[model samples]
Target: MSDYLRLENVSKTFGGIRAVNDVSFALKQGEIVGLIGPNGAGKTTLVNVITGVHPASLGRVIFQGEEVTRQKPFQAARRGLARTFQIVQPFPEMTVLDNVAAGALFGGSPEGLAEAREHAHRHLAFVGLDPIADQPAASLTLPNRKRLELAKSLAMNPKVLMLDEVNAGLNTGEIDTALDLIRRISERGITILLIEHLMKVVMSVSQRLLVLHHGALIAEGEPQKVVNDQHVVEAYLGEKFAKRLKEMGHA
Candidate 1:
């Protein structure tokens, strides 16, 4: 299949500092690709560039066969790209359902508030948040907040979803629930680009992994192989992680 999303020689700079340097990759439709890196490794910067939170200092971003290198965030969303922030930003005073309805209203083709609310209800149910649909978003715990973020994005009816650290603060059981939700989303045929720190989640969910270090692409391949790569281990996972994986017969 042709690439659904392509970042060609993409780079981002703030003042004199290069946050993402000449990164290039292609993501196929219906695939879950993991973007993994250490802190300050440009993972979020790259996502920002893709979502148009920050324009690229160099190169192109092609989505669904169109160049959207300079598209604004809302423009990108209108063209079927949606994202969830690492820090959840639900509308505090809105009911959880209304918060998701806002996404349906703004992210895609224009819709009436009633239709948007219906979409919101469907998506909230999809993320298992239907029981609390009437609650204020600010009332949710961390895990449910993450689900709200996911539901909001889903309500946009996006073809490509970029998730930033959706599993960041969840405990093991909650992480498992998040993983299941993600899998269900994937099953619905949304292409996913995931940035996550948890190796187990990334390894289990991703069809491919991309490793970034110091603002550059260092490795891109199957998760198992990428995790075992010497450079990836040295740069992100460390030798101790590699040794432990080997001890567990995973490397």
Candidate 2:
């Protein structure tokens, strides 16, 4: 597959602090890549820079062979770069269907409300939320809310979807469901950048893994190899536990 998204020496700074530093990677078309790191590892900051929530302080953000280092969030969406937040925030007063409809409209689709609704319902049904599409967005449970978020993002008709902790709050069963949904999405030929902290989830779902430590890309390769790297084990899994797992021939 071709490189659909690329970040070249990207860095993001806030005042005196550097949140992301010289991080660079690429996402191939139709592949699911996992971005994993410990808390405060600047994972979200990198995504922000890519989607234009915060432009990179240095380097370029390229998508589909074009430089978009300074494009705004809406522009990113219109360009088929879509992302889900770590915290799922839906339009509180709107019905679930309408919330997704808003994504289709604002995502740069030239469709009117009627056409947007038509698209939204299909996405909602795909995410298994069509049963309660008329309910207020605020009324759904946590798992269903996450599903609604996926539906909203899908309604945007993304070519590349960056999922930031989409399974953050789910139970084991819910995570299984979410995993299935992600695989189905990938089957539709959408490239996925999954930002996750769960080792089992990332390892199982990712075709490749990128590990970050202190805002730097510490490791990137096959999932097992990256996880076994001393830097990744030390920074993410901690030295002591990694040693134990290694001793047991598990890591």
The candidate maximizing TM-score is 1
Q: For model 1, how big is the CA root-mean-square deviation?
A: 1.0
Q: How accurate is candidate 2 locally (lDDT)?
A: 0.91
TM-score of 2: 0.96
lDDT of 2 by residue, 1-251 (tens): 77899999999999989999999899999999999998999999998999899989999999999999999999999999999999999998999999999999879784599999999999999999999999999999999999999999999999999999999989999999999999999999999999998777887789999988889999999877886898888789887766665566545
TM-score of 1: 0.97
- The C-alpha lDDT values of all candidates are 0.91, 0.91
Backbone Cα, N, C clashes tallied per candidate: 0, 0
Residue 250's lDDT in candidate 2: 48
Worst 10 residues of 1 by lDDT: 242-251
Model 2 ranges with Cα > 4 A deviation = 240-251
